[model samples]
Target: MLHATGSKKELTRLAYYALVSDILEHADVQALKQFRHHRYTTRFQHSLNVSYYNYLLCRFFHWDAVSAARAGLLHDLYFYETNAYDRTESPGQKSHSAHHPEVAVQNAVDRFALNPLERDMIEKHMWPVTHRMPQYKESYAITFVDKYAAIVEFFGLGAQRMLSHIRRKQTV
Candidate 1:
């Protein structure tokens, strides 16, 4: 069982690290650090943030934290360089937003013994963009958190940045 004590942000960080420790140790999961997600964030860092938020939400709502954490961590597991998609001769090549979810799902499935909910969370995270709605609460949680993390990463304003900002404010 995980314990939460401290500021909300600190508690969430603790829960996230506790929940995702196992997944992070997987060789396949570790490879995510090699891929860039958006702006200054690596796929591993973005996924960690998503997984952390999912875990925090699910824990608060009494949902399945395990599934949410695992699926969220694996949600962007499509290992190809995203830039490569642009090099195709034709426009029909697997575009990141339209196609990477399916690819990520397959990769997650191949390596992990995922439950249906976990699989669905990984498969349908892109939602209306991918035309697949989440079939479970955990799926929805992961989907929402994934987008939130992406926005934070895209702007290079995630927890680390927030912390830096906070410290600078305190010193002023």
Candidate 2:
């Protein structure tokens, strides 16, 4: 429902909502809210942040906005504590950044019917870090948006909104 740190937008009212509303309500996606991420943001919010901003960027460029939005939301689909990983990726084992895109793609394919672009976006969002080349322009949008989401969240820009969201959830 929001994007970036210290920024709030009317998400459901925007065209962006219609593109992602289908999967956003799913239990798997909602489950992201339970995992802490970016210190102050939940994975759900982080993904939403990426999704909305990516959609806007792609839309502005007259690219495939739908795929960009959908992929952004599904990009970080894996659910695990981010810091719970071996610092070094062993010969056979992958570091979390290198491994999660694969995990997320597997999880996404199992739950949703993905087009090739969506699949590419979800799988290659990590880009040079994952050493995976993106197959489409929209794929590159996700990589930027994902990083933007992380930087904003890491700096605690969205903490006030998240706190209010938590307070409202508690009241309900």
Candidate 3:
């Protein structure tokens, strides 16, 4: 587990904040267009949503914020668009639900000179419940945060639909 030890916590937090700020400042407008809801959400929005949820999770766990933030930001880099995972998935691929973590790891490797910890977190983000279980604390943190974000996004959409149905019933 990447326990928050000594000054590492402060250093990592600074780095995490800086990275997130940098990413957001340089965020592509086209990428923002990709952000959408489950019913009508875009991939960019989903990534941002994951990021926000990951931030919350990091605070909860007192983790290395830099690792968690990076993992959250890049977790869905492969999706390109919303529902892309579902549209062209192979039947034999274990879980369409959890395929993005490894892809995200690859993206990180290609895009950044990540340390072993960062790479491990991205690669192992979908463990236990995934094809393979997470091996470290940072990895487990990513996995938990990813799952947490997805669940919130899922239920958030479902709740919106449920409320819409209720409103329709009242109108009828």
Give stretches of model 3 more than 4 Å off.
Answer: 1-17, 25-37, 80-91
> Which wins on lDDT, candidate 1 or candidate 3?
1
Model 2: lDDT of residue 117: 98
TM-score of each: 0.78, 0.85, 0.69
lDDT of 2 by residue, 123-165 (tens): 9999888897998999988998898889878766566677888
Minimal lDDT window, size 10, model 1: 1-10
Choose 2 or 3, whichever is better by TM-score: 2
lDDT of 3 by residue, 93-129 (tens): 7464566676767865676567676777767776764
Select the stronger candidate by TM-score from 1 and 3: 1
Per-residue error (Å), model 1, residue 3: 17
User: Where's the lowest-lDDT run of ten residues in candidate 3?
Assistant: 1-10
- Whose lDDT is greatest here? 2
Candidate 3 C-alpha error for residue 62, in Å? 3.3
Q: Ranking by lDDT, best first?
A: 2, 1, 3
lDDT assessment of candidate 1: 0.78
Give me the displacement of residue 131 in model 1, in angstroms. 0.5
